[model samples]
Target: MPKPKIELHVHLEGTVRPALLADIAVGNGMAPPAPSPGRFADLHDFIVTWNATTGCLRTPTDYRIALLAYAEEAAGHGAVHIEPIVDAEPRLGLDGWADVLAACVDAAAEARERYGVSVGLTPQVFRGQDVGYAEEAARIAVRFAGRGVVGFGLSGAEGRHPTLPYARAVALARDGGLPFVPHAGEAAGPEAVREVLAMGAARIRHGVRAVDDPDLVTELVERGIVLDVCPTSNLRLRVADPGRPHPLTLLHHAGVRCSVSTDDPALFDITLSDEYAVAAGLGVDAASAYAAGLAGMLGTDTDRARLVRIGRAAFGGIDVGPAS
Candidate 1:
């Protein structure tokens, strides 16, 4: 078996199996969205697909099924730990958030027993929505912290939606002792990455764009902020040129912490193992990848320590430094 890995940038909605989604949509008396060729034309097209797929999941049971399926698939890819972003937007309603979160927690517990993969939920505030909605999402996240949810995140179109307005929500997450992890530097640029840092982000999803500004890269290194980089997602979204080397290599060489992940694995048609393969292709050794993953995980210290031991044993007793 390959070394045990950790995935920190996955999305539950984005991991729904298309066949299951179609079945659920028909069962709900709703028309299923048309299937695409897997690769999207652009970020907007991808978001449209994402929204349509998530629309099929209307009940708490739907979320439970999706979470379990994601867990099984992630575990198959050798993921020992996964922190997936769960979006409970207008579809589930504010009051329904608790049920869905509880369902996820239950499903995750079952998945741990069945698949040996620890799951953590990170409820996201859609940045494209109004700031009030973000605040409400943060409150719900705070309410569920330590029960099932491990952190708070902001997702959506980063190009048009500035992360500054979500400051109140970020503050609330910080006050609740939840890690602040927001998407940045993918659809947007270095400035967007800077904004999330200002909001006290411990990790930045798809922060590969931070390589554009040397100063910001230095700041990320100095602060020990992890960039959860998804190579295939960047290639599929056209955020990075396929012909060029990925920014993960640049950031890692610059002493910025980075972890490989399969962002929207089902949507991007990739896997955690494939992501590790890509990292290896970029000259990242297994020990270094293990180190980055350990640093990037948002799980409890005990969980982190256990994974380190697993990785060390799996990879021939390689030293992985600290658990972070």
Candidate 2:
């Protein structure tokens, strides 16, 4: 059996199977974007493709189908727990955000029963939009906290919008006991990571660029903030060079906690296991990778304990040390 794992930084819309997207588009009397070379030309290209694909989801039923499909996919890859980011900008409308989130919660409950994979929803605000949108999304996330929504996140064009604008929204999430996890240090740089940190982010998604500043890396280590790093996404987005050593290895060796994830498995054409394989190739052993996953999960205590038991069984009771 494959070793059990936890995935903390995948996106629900990004997990829509290509065939499903085509099916949805055809049924809705819409034209599906033509298939392109699997790799993205740039971040803008990626965002465009991502938006087009997500646009196919028009109802709560559509969201549930996508959620359940992603659950099964992650479970097949040995993910015992997953936190899939859901962008709040509605394909249906602003009111439809509630329906989408409700569907996700229902699908997650069913997924746990069927696949034994615990699911958490992390609703994200598109940074390119106004901060009020973020505040709205954050309030929705806060309302659903512990129901299925486990955290709040900020995603999208990082360079186009600075993190400070969303501070109040992030603060609302923090005050409501939701883990604040925002995307940073990918399209931008280490300073972007710093901005999110100032907003009290418990974890950072794709914070691979923190390695650029030794001081920032040291601060990350000191804070025990986990980074959910997606290696293939970094390469596909051209944020990191494929030929060079990935920042994940450097961050791991520097004592910064890190977890391997497939940010968008379907979109990026990779898997959670594939990410672990890449990490292994870069000299990070399976035990260390699993250890990081355990430490980085945003699940509750019961869920964490379940993952710990699963990990202990799969890795032959190996000493999975503290993340730091």
Candidate 3:
């Protein structure tokens, strides 16, 4: 839709197509989730569905298939670069974690060569999990540093496990020269956003609630910490209604560095293009959407020339200032 945009905050496991998950489950001796999984009542319910889908990913082949499927989907949406969060610990046992990461890198390399789309892997630690697990993820990330691994992230429930819990892991990742990104302000409020900021987060995933704290918003804008905001996920999670009460517009107005993304497109039945379409329908002008996308590209280490080309082609030009 936007000529191969960059997707910054998507989870590779959660983006598994339902049909593929069923197929993988059958192939891998696992049971897929129930037919409809009873309509998700909220974000927690959605996570339940997500874990079930992730059950399909029990082997390296499954990881490869998931990566390839997501790459193909991103390509179909005209996404040139995709940054998918990877959790080697869950899918690949600690002893074989390096092999797991290597498999993902190889799969992404294959996708780039065969499909003409680039995918960068960012290993993630599920917060609310043992802090030791995060440290282990960081260690493994450091081991694979500079080898197709671009950044590190923290996912899972942020409200229960405070951002400071992973402070040491973030520091380790940053020390190893990886960009630090953590989930914050999605289910939690603006306070979570502040905690992530204190932890030296380079980019925040789903920081929509940062609008609730003007001082923090100002600091974010000043420091250039990009928020990868997924609008459809916000609405589906009941964090915000898409139309009247979404704080994304307010965050942009407050000079927050924000970007649009599809958090879990398959789970939510949406895509990067769908995300852009929803934003447009919800009153975010084409230019603002373009800037948001630019902020995302700017926040990452993607190809600058390609980003500039897409930015100009998408909106004729990019102002890259606060949305007014």
What 10-residue stretch in candidate 3 is worst by lDDT? 296-305
* Candidate 3: tens digits of C-alpha lDDT, residues 186-234: 8788888888777777788898888877888888888877788887788
TM for candidate 1 is 0.95
For each candidate, what is the lDDT? 0.83, 0.83, 0.75
Q: What is the lDDT, from 0 to 100, of the residue 202 in candidate 1?
A: 84
Flag clash pairs in model 3: 4-78
**Best-to-worst lDDT order:** 2, 1, 3
Off by over 4 Å in 1: 316-319
Per-model clash counts, in order, read 0, 0, 1
Model 1 lDDT vs. the true structure? 0.83
User: Could you tell me how far off, in angstroms, the CA of residue 135 lies in candidate 3 after the best superposition?
Assistant: 0.8
Write model 1 residue lDDT over 20-111, tens digit each, in one string: 87887888789986774478777777888888777888888988899899888888878889998888587677878768888888898899
- Count of clashes in candidate 1: 0
Estimate the TM-score for candidate 3: 0.90
- The predictions' CA RMSDs to the true structure, in order, are 1.7, 2.0, 3.2
- For candidate 2, the per-residue lDDT at 77 reads 84
